[model samples]
Target: MDSRRSPLGRAALLLVALVALPAAAQGKKPKEGAYVPAPADQIPGYSAKVMPCEIIEELIPPRVNCEGELLEGKSLRELAILRNTIFARYGWAGFRKPWLRDHFQKQPWFKPNPKFTYKLLSDADRKNVHFIGVREQSFTERELRRMEDTIFARAGKVWNDVYEWKLKDGRTVRSCAEPQDPLDEKEGCTGANCEGTHSRDCFFREEKWYRPDPKFSEDKLSAEDRIDLGLISRSLGSFASDTGKLEKGAQASLDRVISVQELRQLSLRDLRLLRNTLYARRGRPFKSKILQAHFKAMSWYRQDPNYTDARLTENDKRNIALIRSVEDEFGGPLKDEDWLIDPATDAA
Candidate 1:
């Protein structure tokens, strides 16, 4: 018997040839999916190879529940990407806003499927979506702008500040200033932190996501966003109470060193009290009637006729100066004399 010419020998050689053909032709082992990229002519009017939709999810690593430290420092945009990309992976396209459809479509691997639907999301997908949604509530935009703002803020788009406080009278104000008409209005800074602008130094700046448009208006948000905003307002019943207080509830300023990062979370209105709070701690007389009234309300505030900066702790001075500097940067230099007044003196 000649083993070289055996039927088994021929079949074994054929199997080896089949296994090695692909790798040999490509000069590398096939990837996990062995996905074939479309050629220049493979996709209409394209001159370069494009990846198939099957591998788009591979661009970003999948998370396990997207929990804890995984989400810790992630920016609002990053979270949106993590959550929405799951939908994009299944060809969900964009929300009614259309702000993001081009984003996923621009990806070489993206190939939209008409059959995509929310029902297609897996249990794991729903969990990640819910997790990101809950974590998103902590951000100022989400808290102030409601759910739809989450999508807009991530794209670095600026809309008129929808969050406004209604006065006892018919007047309305936003960011402590009168609300401007959305039509025929100029874009400018509103809050102490320029909450209205999309400057690189804005809060979203940390994540390099802010791309504000001076002309962009809240009217630009989708009808769906407006509808959702209305439903949210109705559900909550009323916003007569300023939401800002909830953010600043008893936050410490004089006790420890404060960082700019921590300050970034605060509204400018909060920073105003934070700096003044430092002075109030030493029983320093506040000339500003508002400041005086605020200190009077605090149980800890004991006005000392002889209070002086000299009585302040080293930490207090540093914290005060830091808070003042940050405030001035956001809200032009407001002289201390503007807020603190000299105590009255009398001849003996």
Candidate 2:
């Protein structure tokens, strides 16, 4: 292998190199640490009009790789598609889950091998499986943040960017650009304009999906909103203030107030979470596996060695005491369920 070689040595080296090329092309097993997926090839009569399996060995892909949809946006049915697609990428159990098999059977790249076992799963596979499973029971940081925004959005409350607007005359309108049809400028605005939005003409879209309420106020929020807002505030730190950060979360929780009406909206289990979230924010860990696992799932949760009840705000203390009183009426603290582990949180 020396670079300084005789002409005879060079010729012998060339012969050895020529001998190795054919073996590689002929599909000789590569040395250890070099593993390539079996080339996606046709299996005659294996599937009706096949293409390659779209699933590749990738990490817990962003949004778990569900097209354009974020992970939180993925419906349960969509999640099923992801799980089945993963399995189908490996050993597709033919005829068993025909609906599933038939779905990917048309992919020409899909090469099913019945010899599939847990041992064959790549790190990506294991992490994806666990991540997806855990997420099914809990919300990730992104989902939590979105849910925080959505709570206000559902109440017709608008922040800096209002896509739709409630016109003065009771006609719901848009804030108001992005016209669909170019022929007429009045198409989106209906020829009228709404207040201060970037788009002068506020046209009502056909669906009328997001009509902002002009009269939306904290006092007018539904009981459900009040409870949820409080719960989220307890988890997150605070609401939007003069600093121009996110303008979200519960004022009742922030202002040292918790109402019986809000408490009624939560279950005994949720009552426990609403209570513990205050502790969780200060880096306190939970003795219960349920609470520990649940809080650990949240990205914002940090275990603090110096965490103590004294770290809690006056509002936090008041909310905790109020929630605890309600829990007592229901026969004391609940045995937390890993079930219904969905919702979200943030302290500030």
Candidate 3:
């Protein structure tokens, strides 16, 4: 039943009036009381019938449910800075501000670095910055093992769904190698029709030919695949939180250290996504960092999987390997050359 309305129905009248009011009459601005609706027809060539109806959720505040003391939560100021910086760097706009703020500020280990001053760099100072201090949460042996298991389980599904099928025709046209038949035509052994008994002495047994199916090649994971992947990732995140092993709750705010060689092995698209994400975290422009990340990831791939970088999981190694075949073919990574924009000299 509509609790917003009182028994007298006066509240219902007030609510309807509030909803029907224009933006100018709302009288409240963001951070004050309520979010006013932005006009839908403000865009160029806008039409009411052709345009989609969008609900502005910010107008309604979220209901807060507290289990016990609100003070029991973790501080996440550092995580907020990281998250904000990433979005700003990537030129991405219109993210859910409240969600971003809440996610970052809720992490167990996120604390404000008051000593650090936030700096917005111009075209200059692109490459001079070195050695950004990134803090990663420490996971206990149990937590690490759990994460490893979760990653393996998730990747296993992807591998099976994407690439698990036996060739139908067998190896090659091989004849009967049974001692009873030897190399006779009566023994269901023919060079063209039977398993290649004729090539018993061949280096590789290619006698059994396999007929590859185009339908099998056409099969692919769809949107459900990503949903399943996200479920596994979220489960892993939950495990991290349960074990007190998270510096931040926001997915983009994690300061994970992945090797260059490791990045090289992921699918090219995935590698680019990761690289873009990392670039956003750095508060720097994306240049040749993709190439650098890919190269470094490959270098790491050549070594043992146990190498500790906090970022390289066994699953990442496998994923990267699948994507490493694609070439970057882009310009070399960003340069440190500073082109000074003189205030006095204006020649445009």
Candidate 4:
């Protein structure tokens, strides 16, 4: 039927043609080998605002012309997704396409294309990109070594200056002191008559001087010089002798000894009795067993009775050697009473 012949027929034909136009367009597909640009919203699950500089910078990784001009924007996750998508679809050939290149260059949010290349990014940036599913080149051994050396050097510097002290009241403190101000005094100082003089006597109220324990010799400083520098802790020094002896399995050494505070509270007679008891118990297996049981009740006892010198763990042996070395400098065990006596009162 010729729909154009009459008014009614013509009106019906126009309606049919209008309905067929959309269906015909829908059936048409893109030609093979044609480059269809990915839609802006093609990347699913990513809706964050992307900066043009981030895209351009990632695209040109071999040069560094974009510094300072790149806007500091958010949505790093979305940018990463976009970067990977473009690279996967077009490779380096995508940048050669005028349309694709112009699309990024015309972004009004950033300046015109800043020249950059993949080589321009730092190792950290490379790692970040790789973490986002980009296959980046692995770091060479030399680069890895440089990073490791930097870490070790920083750690060594921190450890070399660190010092720890064990105080008379059974407290441990750590410090990082230089030779000029080894005691780390406050700027103005404290206590009575300390305003004018920055002397140790005026600043240190507890004793004429305090010394750090020998265990702190793990630093670069020599143990003897460190002790002479008044870094020794009284409580630690007092126990040092006995602790050193016990570690070496010395027959004369007791498995347990009284703390400085405990010894201070004892009467003269009690002190003598305790010493005699220790001397009598020396080298006696039954007494050793009894002492071991008593030591086990204390909070500080870590070794099991079954672990002897022959069966000592590597750590225990190392500790034994350290204590032995330090004890050799003292000539013998350093008892708590040696440092506890008030020399002023005794002299009178």
What RMSD, rounded to one decimal, does every model reach? 25.0, 19.4, 23.5, 33.3
lDDT for model 1 comes to 0.43
Task: Report the lDDT tens digits of candidate 1 across residue range 197-279.
Answer: 43322334345556666666555655445434432321121111111211122324235686765554333334566677777
List where candidate 3 sits over 4 angstroms from the true fold. Answer: 1-81, 84-119, 122-133, 137-141, 144-321, 325-348
**Model 4 — TM-score against the truth?**
0.16
| Reference-based lDDT, each prediction | 0.43, 0.46, 0.27, 0.28
Tell me the RMSD of model 4 versus the true structure: 33.3
Off by over 4 Å in 4: 1-35, 44-82, 89-182, 185-348
lDDT of 2 by residue, 268-313 (tens): 5456777887778778977776577667757767998777778888
Order of models, best lDDT first: 2, 1, 4, 3
Global CA lDDT computed for model 4:
0.28
Candidate 4 per-residue lDDT, tens place, 1-348, comes to 001123343334334433432211256554564333334365342222322222222321211122343312212223323343333222222232232344345443222212212222223322233233211111222332233223223223222223443434544444322223223344332322234323222122223333323343224433332221111111111122211221223322234443444333222212322442332332212233323332233233345434334543354344334443333322222222321211100000
Best by lDDT: 2
TM-scores, in order shown? 0.26, 0.37, 0.18, 0.16
Runs in model 1 deviating more than 4 A are 1-253, 333-348
For lDDT, candidate 2 versus 4, the one ahead is 2
Per-residue lDDT of 1-348 in model 3, one digit per residue for the tens?
001122234323323422342333345343444322223233222122311212222221111222332211212223223324322232222223333334434543333332211122221211111100011111222333344333333333211212111223332233223232233433433343345322222212232432222343212333333323332232222211211122334443234444444333222223334433332333333245322332232211232344343444454444333333221321111121100111000000
